[model samples]
Target: MPSHPNYSNQGNKFAPAKTSLREAGDLYGQKEFHIYQNAIEKMRAHDDQLPSLPIITLEIRKATSNPNVNLNHLSSLIAKDPSLTAILMKHASSVFYRTADKPKNLQDVIKRLGMGAIESLTLSHSIKSLFVLRNHQLKALYKQAWQRQTLKACMSYHLAKTLHFPNPEDAIVASLLSEVGTLALLSSLQDYAAPAAPTYKILCQHYSKHLGAILLAKWGVSPVFVDVLRKTGAWTLDTGRLLQLVDVINLGLFHTIHYLQPQNDLIPLQEIAAFKKLNPQYAMIKQQKLLIIEENISHILQLQKNFE
Candidate 1:
């Protein structure tokens, strides 16, 4: 069969190649397949130059993990990073918080956000630095990917809060980290130059979970969070009798995809097993899921404006 042409960045845009569609796909796939594998192998061998978790992020994670987290100390740490402090203040004053008054200062922002949301926001603010690249096209691709992940993370957090899930913040962290593999794979592609968009996406879908799980484990992330990487797009996922963070992550992923590609042929939310589990506990989700999504979409756009 005649296949779509995979254009090389260096070549004429309309130049035809002798390669068949299947051949082109296989060639691109094989090349990226190797790159993805190499990236994973390097991570496994602990010799990769992939970005390490930021120290401020680590400190925030440690502080928040404690039940007795000191808001004053935590605010002080975040205040040390002026940009982060600004992001937090902007987020606290955002319409999503529904606060009657704007935060007076960093400590007020920290108090309004709470430790869990603070952790998620802190990590989200710093995640972009992890995937920086000199390749312009690849860099744009990574930026889009990062933005989508951030939106998904916000969607997860909102979904959890809407459903009254116990640890909504966990949903945010899990959803954000779900794309760790994709970012890492894209970073690896910097040296390989840009692959056709479809090829890179295929590589991400096929191998991101494995690579992400490996990287998160190495970073000392909780297994519960690491498992979110494994179950990200599992539409049929059923995790025990109760709704869990992974279920929220799955639902968030579904909504994020639907929001980005409304015409996509994804399974309807009512039909998905995750939504089914949530339906029994929160019937309002079935009725207001779209509204919930609409609100999250608005919030995501606002966040991009603030942080971008």
Candidate 2:
């Protein structure tokens, strides 16, 4: 069994609350673990079937990596997907991306937004498309996961803004991809004849980080985002170095879990090394207050409505 970097010894006084998961692993004997490994191998063999961005998007991603890639080349790729074309045009004309006049076509959108914003939008949609699972039984599961992720993304956005982080959208993107590992794992099990087994869920937790990075790489997601997948769930990491994005993600997870299950024993914010670096007073965000019971219930609703 491939083990993740032990997240427990953050050198903090509090022990990591991975006991439930670790205990779950213990409950699954060697035979159960092998069943998952075999299923995972079966899924990996049919890699092409895994949901991903259209080839055009992947091509644009590769082309954009070249600093000197021509803008016309990008336009050509964007024109290939009508769905992508419509989405880019609609968003490019929205209040945020709109120029003085509405852009008429894909070429106009690229020119107006520039390659950086265009790339992010493309990657965002590309990654999100994977969440539209083919398995109908998983619809309820996807909805629960998507809603939770949206909440975390919203928390990350406000946290980044409050901390004066330059890119709040990074936090949102990170939040969405945070569950990639589990999602990828479950999708691989779509053809596994067994019911959604307990050991499969446990295995997803164990190997999610590694599997997530692979999926992101396949989609040509930026390395920074790949790094985000690795570290956001790490509670005890030195927040001083990766203070803004990484710390905001940790905070987002904490609050999202706290909202979902008020009594969850995942690390307290005050005790977390990342939150400690913040002023803790939340002085920057005077207007927006979270509720003690619901704990940002309105924010959760707003995020679901916006992202859904």
Clashing pairs in 1: 3-21
Model 2, span 50-107: residue lDDT tens: 6677677668777766788887877888888777787677656654444678997777
Residue 111 error, candidate 2, Å:
8.5
Model 1 bad stretches (over 4 Å): 1-25, 28-47, 67-70, 280-291, 303-307
Q: Per-residue lDDT of 209-305 in model 1, one digit per residue for the tens?
A: 6666667876777788887777767677677777788888877777776666554446667777677775654534533255666645776667556
Score each candidate by Cα lDDT.
0.68, 0.62
lDDT of 1 at 196: 64
lDDT for position 15 in model 2:
18
lDDT of 1 at 88: 82
> Model 2: residues >4 Å from true position, as ranges?
4-27, 30-34, 44-52, 59-117, 131-134, 193-197, 279-300
Return model 1's CA RMSD, one decimal. 6.3
Q: At residue 207, give the lDDT of candidate 2.
A: 67
